[model samples]
Target: INRLSSALIRTSTKCINALDALRSLKDGLDQHPSITKEEKERLLNFISVARQEYDEIAKKEIQKAFVYSYEESAKVLFDNYLDNIEAYCNSTKLKDPITDEEVSPDEKLMRSIEEQIGVSENAKKSFREEILLRLSSYARKGRKFDYTSHERLREAVEKKLFADLKDVVKITTSTKTPDAEQLKRINGVSAKLISEYDYCPVCANELLKYVGSLLNR
Candidate 1:
């Protein structure tokens, strides 16, 4: 049961991290072509704050959910992508800071999907496939691969993941763990990120969006 719980938590964290990546991408798009110097500075400010908020959220989520071995392994990949994103966002700001009026929720989400997933056409498809892959791993058990039972288990798994995720954010202040060596290995290759970006950009982006939407539960 403890292992199961940890697996579920890791699954949830992956979903959240993926979603946040997409969200960051969307924010970049929505704020593109800063209209003025002031706008650019404002954009930078907003991004800094958003990045801080995102980092904080990720730390809490990961610490609480990744108590199991599988989760810890999975997070190495997630952290690598996040590290890249952090670099990307910072680079963008250094290039040209800008802020615009609020963007629509849908547009924001779309851009997020694009950035976290990828700007390339094939990269996006790979992202969706990765999500499915992780979902499969999370939902898998060592028993005889029972489809009916698997489906039911997935539903329950999702439910528990969300419940704990929400509780951690609401009831606790923060949760963070250090595993620098593990992170180094996971981020070193970006195996998971590459797997997700293996599909066509258009299809992959759509798939990520669809999967992220389901995470609302």
Candidate 2:
């Protein structure tokens, strides 16, 4: 949609420019002593209609561009959310065995799922790196920067990892409780990451510092 909108705008702009050139030619023609007033009036009216059409087209093009941008942003957000969910599931190590013929997902199939998840994670990492580079370039130019994009990227990465981990857990009729200490550590780590996003000048730097602190402890 964005591409289509851009094309429309480009085409409209060109048309408008051409119309302007035509009007200039008409004005030159009107200056001729031999030209009749009727001919001049006709040419001016045609130019007026053409200009009006160009303005309308320009407005429609702008609307289309805005719609395209909004849709694109929504899609990106959804993708990021799914990725985060997968990462969270993987981190939790919630998986079920398939050999018993009781689990929804079979062991072999689950392993394949994990492989796919890894591919997604690698892709997310690549995207995150690209965004970071872009953010850095913008920052150097003294432009405003937001961590929302990176936050979404990280969420997607973690969710994809979690989906694979979910396949590893054993399925049972009753819900099983996890170790409180492990859960606490996971929460703590996540909180630290969130803080880094909210407060740090450079997200990468903050992440490194947080990790270093964790290691030291």
Writing each residue's lDDT as its tens digit, candidate 2 over 1-217 gives 3333333365434322333455555556645778788987887788788876755543332222222323444345444433443434334332333454322223233233334335354455454346557666877999854433455443333343433223221111011343664344333433443453342233322333333333234
Off by over 4 Å in 2: 1-16, 72-217
RMSD per prediction, one decimal?
24.1, 22.3
Weakest ten-residue segment in model 2 by summed lDDT: 166-175
> How far in Å is the alpha carbon of 73 misplaced in model 2?
7.6
**Residue-wise lDDT of candidate 1 within 1-217, one digit each (tens)?**
3333333365434333333454454455454564676776676677667766655554433332332223443344333333333334334322212455432223232234344323455554444344445545656754432211334323333333334444432322221342664444223223322353343333333333343333433
Off by over 4 Å in 1: 1-34, 68-217
How many clashes does each candidate structure show, in the order listed? 21, 21
